[model samples]
Target: MVERRRFSRIIYQAPATIRQGGTVVEANIQDLSLHGLLLSTDGNNAELNCDILADIEFTLPSSDIVISLVANLIGIQKNIIHASIDHIDIESIAHIKRLVELNVGNDDLLHRELEHLSDLGEHLSDMGEQL
Candidate 1:
């Protein structure tokens, strides 16, 4: 298959909790990117569903700063879950950007990805306005 990812993914493991409605499940982040994350749980969380919105909270490794964001559960395969970020606060986004920047090791590439993300957001906002 062709790769369509616009953001660079970095392998960073961290414990995360996903909360949807009244259900909460613990998962380990397998990898992270600016736009999405891959999580691994012991088993498929039957309570979570694809296309549902959820809140994911996790702290940076060796740091007390908590990064929390709203994401959409887009896919699940056995023990792995895929979530696409839908909304994130300023502080969390800043932390995430710095984490990604450190891992990517290329400031220009990281800036390009940020630009793409910003463009996508603007396009989505325009679509929302039209609708």
Candidate 2:
């Protein structure tokens, strides 16, 4: 029963730094999507609605292009923070997308297709329960 609209989540562990104002805090990126990212940090100081800047360093699988993206933190839950890339950060995502398109095999497509099938099944199940 995943509540998120984006069901296709690729888990990746990478070092991240969240800079709020002048203070910088270290964290880890647990999951990623085109929309937002899940961050695991130590302290609970990352508030629900606090916006912070994140410097993420991660390597694309099988590629030597280790990229760092500066993103904006959008929300927090428990010790995990969620962030969405601002408009200016689209280029970075675009670069990643291109890399995935070039390198990824049929597995990525299969997973995305399975996610849609699961959503359909869930919708039908909900309708059955309602009836």
lDDT of 2 by residue, 1-131 (tens): 95855434466667666666566667787876554578888884443336446555566566675656766767776788877654324556666555434444556774674566457658878998999
Candidate with the greatest TM-score versus the true structure: 1
Cα-based lDDT for every prediction: 0.93, 0.62
Instruction: Kindly provide the TM-score of model 1 when superposed on the true structure, using C-alpha atoms.
Output: 0.96
In lDDT terms, how accurate is model 1?
A: 0.93
Give candidate 2 misplaced runs (Cα > 4 Å): 1-4, 44-72, 88-91, 98-131
Off by over 4 Å in 1: none
lDDT of 1 at 131: 100
How well does each candidate superpose onto the true structure, as a TM-score? Answer: 0.96, 0.55
Best by lDDT: 1
Pairs in steric clash, model 1? none
The alpha-carbon deviation from the true structure for residue 24 of candidate 1, after best TM-score superposition, in angstroms, is 0.6
